[model samples]
Target chain A: MLESIMHWWEKKQYRIAPYLFISPFYILFAIFMVYPICFGIYLSLHEWSGIGEMAYVGLENYLNLFKDGDFYLAFSNTLWYMGASLIVNLVFSLILAVLLNSALVKCKKLFRTIYFIPIVTSVVAAAIVFTLFYDRDYGLFNLLFVAMGGKPLDWLGDTSLSKFAVIGLIAWRWVGFNMVYFLAGLQSIPKSLYEAALVDGANSLQCFLKITIPLLRPVILFVMVTTLIGSIQIFDEPYVLTGGGPADSSMSVVIYLFRTGMEYLNLGYAAAIGFVLFGMTFVLSWIQLNLMGAFERKE
Target chain B: MKRTLLLILVALMIMVVVGSSGAGAQEEVTISMWTHDNLYVEFFTRRGEEWAALHPEYKMNFKFTQIPYDQLWPKILTTLAAGTGVPDLIGIEISAFSRFMKGDIAEQALVDLTPLIGEEKEKFLRWEPYMHNGKIYGVESALCPVVFYYRKTAFDEVGVSTPMETWEEFTQAGSKLKEKDRYIAAIESSGDTPHHFLALYYQQDGAIFNSKGELMAEDDPRAIQALQFLQEGVREGILWPTSSYFDAPHFAALKEGRVVGNYMADWWSVYYQKPQLPEQAGEWRIQLLPAWEEGGRRSSTAGGTGFAITKYSKNPELVFDFLHYTYMTKENQIKRFLELQYFPTMIEAITDPQITEFSDPYYGDQKVGKVFSEAALQIPVQWQSPYWSEAIQILYKEAITPVVADKKTPEQGLKDAISKIRALMK
Candidate 1:
């Protein structure tokens, strides 16, 4: 083994081969990621309101963040949105994947494609479609609701209901995508384990509980981590739908950061918000991992 | 590897040689101008060629960016912050011109065109927002005054005679019009724009900022009265559902005889009374905004924009001359008024035979030019300081939008707005 390793190291291309393979990622990362992040942190220390001399505010922006009531409202809204969406999406996708995995499901490819259509559709186009869907007066949704003896719900306008409307949209677009992942994990489960459980006179549901779920632990962890990260960075849907109002009821943390940096032209304050958002995301994700681990071990 | 490196080096050397070779050559000075309207691109492109013909030695380099008014302020501010490659000429709105004027942002970043164009201060009327410390910074380009456009058929159907002057009569007529299965007015909602509240407040003797530049909307009785009028209008079912006025259906609704009147600025006449609505062409009439206190004080803001030379411009002289020729010149002003239906800012354009001679087929050959010109002169000028945008946004968002949404009472909303704005001012 030592002689073979020496032979491998003696190969002519060994010195440059690894670096040549990784150079693309390194170059792109340096240009796009590393430089911007360093510059953004530097920008956070100064008071630059899009004009004139840059006053050295140091930690003033972070201090101001403590008092900004709007930031708190936005923070709570983001948490509520993420919490609600995660619960809804996970349950719905898992149920969907299980149902699709069953033998009764016909033309599975066609059904999958139909379900996946919304995921691939342009966000702006979907937003416009949802705008019509949420329209109070002449909307098809209200028409159906009114026919069923229900009052016409102002889905997009009402501050309380607006988040649900946006979440419904998020779930609509992402459920199929997440379902595919779950389905792959389900397929990857060892068939003999389920068969052996069945040999012990266990039912299909029992076998799934006893073996399938335990096998799908790694997949669930991957999905949970990814979805959590994606949901926390939610910007476009809330931005296009509500514009952070009817009194900021739907203002996500990212939307607030955008308004600070772009609209209010306070880049330093925006950067401070960015760091706070990063901390929140990291802490919440760690908690999610711990909870998921507890659930995994129980199974 | 050496050959490849040599090739890359040779290319770089050639590019540098080509770039520096033109340094000692006759320099071409390009003036960058940013405009919000897409129509400006067409207007400037044509004018640029003409200007270029007049001065062959200096190329008239034009840079146009279409930024809508809502997003213009933030984009301008952010671009300015980048501290590189800003448009030398930016089309500043009358509403937002003060924001730049307040801080040394414009003062430091823009050229003092006073020395070059200061001799002709009297040539323009009312220069508060565009000038700082008695120095001319911007040029007046367009006039935007609020005008009342009512459906003639709706008026005749309601048996209301031409031109109701008093607020009570206006309200009564609006109520009467609503009674005939017609909406009283298709006014823009306060939630979207609270500046209408300020306009209505001013019409009712309310002032936004007090003598010491303190925001006084909350305790100001006039603001309360104005909000009451809006609330009353909503209560009386005179106002239609909140919808986009610019949408073609809104115009079609007017033509199909749904809505009676719309309180809109003169700029709207271009889109509203057009060949597309030839059937309703002869049935529309323009009138002055209804007096808030029964003809007690028929005064509001003199609305329009003035052009300014940015301090960052390498060619201030060229930009000032462009403004003078295109906007300030009586001949070009009349030409624009005739072509684009813009109410010219020049005082002489008001009385010029060119304006009086024009007839718009859209308004059934009504002398639109003469009407707008008269209204432009009578418009009351207001204090436009640098803090106006921040103040207005605060007032609109905190006070006006909340009241309109019924989140808070008009009094409570205005009070909140005042308190919030006071904090920002400090």
Candidate 2:
């Protein structure tokens, strides 16, 4: 009887094994992600302070989110940062990769390692170091500017200028990481394409534009999308360096959501803010892809 | 083979029962206390070993867990919401203390600390902050009364005496002192204007909330005047602006003779000046914060923390036992002040003859304890509502920060903060 039961169990296991293997991920996702998102959506229609009774508030939270000037300010800041970083990152990382890949540049491995160092460094540490650099008085940047006959500028303290300072910090950390991808894309392209261009009397610039740019388009698009996604969730650099201050000039959308949810404990309103950001991200990503012709066939 | 498997299993089961029953005799009741204060953790961990030795019969174990100051509130909120994983005791920041006191203490997921205060509860200074109705929910172990920290060397060079008797004298001194490239003080930029604003607002008996927990800051002449004073200081170039009070630039300014005064708590006397500005060791002195007018209220609290026991605690009595030994006992409170530099909250500890008599070399041989003790008594009792955290942020973001940055006039900033806070209450 035992032998029969064991044999029967093994046969049943063969039928159900694949589902059982995949169930853990789906179960965890349902619990952690799906449940929270749904609950958050439910919470968006109520007012709760965690310890107090949650009072139902209907669509008021979303209405208030639309009216909040701070929300619009933070949203604009995040978009500006995302756009500026995409252009600077893609252009600069491509330049760095091309220069490092050139024949005249020796010790490429050592140079690449040095460039990649900031990618692995902690964001908080880099933000702190950059804060020292950007100090209005007695900082390296200001002193250097003064030495070169320019008046010292308040880099992180001025509302108009703080967004750019945050952008510069993001560039310092992510430029090398983007270059590594471009380097891989450059390496994978057959040398024959470049050689053929050279044989056709094309100069280095001509070869770069014709062979590199057109072929590296896919990698550039990937870099742009990933950078945009990362930008949508940016928090630490400004949080550490400027604290989103000098008058909330560097406050990103996600940081505003965080302050609402964690600091203020307006979970319902914070949930509405989060979903609005989610909608914005989805539409923005969609528009970005269409503009970049990501879905177009290879030419 | 099957019989052998059964016999091995039976033997393992018998071993498990005996071992489990034997281990029950030595099981220790570990009480976890969470705090954001790192110095307190190191002190408590050492003291806990002593506490455990004295209570060997109970088989007690004490554990101290430190959380970051900002994250502690959310951690408590989540654990309480989930109804599990709450530590036995938590150090509640004074800013966050009011939010945890829902109707009754039990409904609020806090153990009523009424029994802990016992018969002599009147002696706990600033104890009003952690109590509700007739019951107390927590007790502070430190008095964080603000005092004026000034540079004696800078004042002497400018031909001024110690402790400008009033703000008018302080400002007059600043104009004269600037010839030597010195400012009277550094009003921390828009970023930290609220803290200084609070100290000044308290000088004139301004309260953020009335006794019945209503928003009351609109058109308060004291608050507006206090904000205007700070803005005027910045505009006159008497108050240098740093990103915040304790940032790198601020420290550099404090270390050198760039700025002279800091209106901060007594703890900063040791924590900030002793280590950060050691060169100004004997050149520094403590004076009561200069009054808004002659003989006005002299001192107020900026920030501090207190201890609260969680309702989820399996042994609330035992947790309070440990807290009482550490905080309520007169000898331990005095010991904490004498050794660890944590200023006392207990009235007896604050006025301990030993504490007042000990001379601090850092402050030019000033009896630091005696000076601060008198200042602590002058701290006016002000009621705080749960909306205080929200109100303070609005004051910073809408009023003080914008005013300092010149984005808004001082009057306009104050009006905006009032309107915004009014909207929040709705």
Best by TM-score: 2
Clashes per prediction?
11, 0
DockQ, in order, for the candidates? 0.24, 0.38
lDDT of 1 at B218: 62
**Per-residue lDDT tens digits of candidate 1, residues B70-126?**
677776776676767777787777766765654457677677767876666666555
Best by lDDT: 2
- Kindly list the per-residue Cα lDDT of model 1 for residues A50-87, writing each as its tens digit: 67777788898888898987789888899888887787
Regions more than 4 Å wrong, model 2: A1-13, A51-53, A198-204, A297-299, B1-27, B46-56, B98-107, B131-135
Q: TM-score of the A chain in candidate 2?
A: 0.93
**Which digits, one per residue and each the tens of the lDDT, describe model 2 over residues A7-95?**
99888988888989999999999999999999999999998877657889899999998788888989999988888988889989999
lDDT of 2 at A230: 85
lDDT of candidates 1 onward, in order: 0.71, 0.81
